[model samples]
Target: MAATVRAAEAGENFPVALRILPARLRSELHATYRYARYVDDLGDELTGDRVAALEAVAAEVRRLYAREPVTDPVVAGMGPLVRRAGVPADCLLRLVEANLRDQDHPRYQSFAELLDYCRLSANPVGEVVLTIFGAATPDRVELSDRICTALQLLEHWQDIGEDYAEGRVYLPKEDLDRFGVTEEDLGAARAGDALRRLVAFETTRAVAWLGAGAPLVSTLHGWARLAVSGYVAGGWAAAGRVRRADHDVLGGQVKPTRSDIAAAWAEGLLRRAG
Candidate 1:
């Protein structure tokens, strides 16, 4: 499980950038990552009653906060770091709630509804991260929310086909109707013009959110600045990939190469410097 978790984390741009941090910080972040990933797996990949599994995980999180014994290895691993970092219980619980919502709510009706889902599913991770860095101020968290939501939308746009296959659709129903896209379009081997236009519209919104959040890098310092710049850069690089693909995300997962991430990272840092 440890090996699998690390392997999966390696593929993400955020974790890839965290490699440069000090060992202690990396370990703390990894513990949080493991717990989040474990919960996500329970929700998405578990064989038995997923809601029950998630409820059990939530219990473990509460136990961790109570300083009681935790049975789950991932939750046990997070206990020390979460306690030490003063991470809020609500942040973790909100994540579990998001997964619970996933079990029942597969399709989002509007972008506002999708954003509400992201408030639960994505934003708390950023809040936890900020808390870990001792930087979870209201202003910073507000900015972090934008970055996190943008990342969530980008991932959704990229995984449209896969999500549709899983009986889930992250794109808003209203947007689909506006673009003349249907569930059938998501299942196609390639995106048609209508699907491409829908992706383009969503991509534009994501980019705007990312841009709105980019100033967060300038507000941070040292490792925090570098780490956040990497995140924002990854978002930009991903947006670039979608644009370059002409917003046809159904061809495959549009992953940004390491070189692409590096270039964007440098450019972002330079922009901040200027």
Candidate 2:
């Protein structure tokens, strides 16, 4: 599991900027990442009874909160940070619940439903990170939700083909129908014109969400500011990649290069500074 987590880190939408962060903060963030990745792997890759596996992780989360011994190494590793940051049990449990939902809910009916799934799968991570930095006010959490949800949408946009192959479709049925994108279109080697149009629409929506959450960067200070800016930068870089591909997501995964991320990072900081 440890090795798998490390390998998966390279492909994350927002790579942990470990070099720029303090040692303790890096460790804390990595612990959180490990826990999340472990749960996701169980839901998406496990060979048998994925729901049961997620339920086990959910039970471990409850144990962590109740001061009982945790059997899962990743959850047990989160003990110190959770206690130190006063991280809410519900935040972590929501992650587990999201995976549980994945087991039963393979397709989303609407964009609102997709956002609700993001509430469970993505927003809680931001909430926990803010709590660790002692910055999770209600207002900040609201902004973080926008940012997290945007990031989740960007990921789904990038992985449309891969997700469809796995018998899961993150694209809402309503949006697909509106754009005349059949499920068969999603599995093709290249996106048809209608699919590209749908992707462009979804990309625009994600970018707007990122813009709505951009204020969260200015509201933070020091490392927190830098970290949040990096996240926003990542979103921008990813959106640019999609646009540069003409929004044809089925051609390949739209991943931003390191240089793209660095350029976006600098631009984000400058914009925030100005």
Candidate 3:
């Protein structure tokens, strides 16, 4: 199956700049997102030594850049985009490194550690988007990093239960200890006071990041502006859902509903217009 079909069938929640971009740009962005999704699935879902599999995937990406034959359909599909749009090879490589880190470290020792992982896992996609859109200045890249990291953190909070089921824990050990939340607390059907407090702390951090990076939206115009604003809005909306749920991530998957995402996008458009 194609990467796009696989991602749709698997129901991955990864977002791209598709909704607001022009048709041509939207196609490029979708192809890029699909490639990333393919790499992530290889690392997370497939059995065996994921480290080796990720390395092989990275090699295919390198081959694509080198104009060599790429066996994987997803990598082959990304070839024209990477070649034409100047998508940085290093940025895509960082994503593979992030997944490799997952194999090496199932739990984070500190918030800083988690942020480092986000730098690898999440920031690259934002950078790739900006690069493809011709808006990747150093300032914009910095802002994009903030938004992407915030989104990654928010996703982590929302999928705490799912991650736990996979034998991975994104909540920093220090925070859990600080809040007196044990691993058992995370596995509970409902979040206890300690887990709630910990989630609240994380939510505050994500909110701060969204606030810090929100300016990126106003820095552009047209489709790029709308796309970035939607990204910022999505982060805000997801974080809002977590807050609205009173940080009870264990009770259910804490994610924004469709209406929440629509509201966020509209609010962002209005803010840009005003």
Output the number of the TM-score-best candidate: 2
Candidate 1 wrong stretches, greater than 4 Å: none
Instruction: Output the better candidate (1/3) by lDDT.
Output: 1
> Over the full model, what C-alpha lDDT does candidate 3 score relative to the true structure?
0.83
* All candidates in order of TM-score, best leading: 2, 1, 3
lDDT by residue for model 2 over 135-245, one digit each (tens)?
999999999999999999999999999999999999999999999999999999999999999999999999999999989988999888778788888899999999999
Ranking by lDDT: 2, 1, 3
lDDT of each: 0.87, 0.90, 0.83
lDDT at position 42, candidate 1: 86
Candidate 3: count of backbone clashes, pairs at least 3 residues apart or interchain: 0
TM-scores for every candidate against the unseen true structure = 0.97, 0.98, 0.93
For each candidate in turn, give its C-alpha RMSD to the true structure in angstroms.
1.1, 1.0, 2.0
Off by over 4 Å in 3: 2-20, 272-274
Give each model's clash number: 0, 0, 0
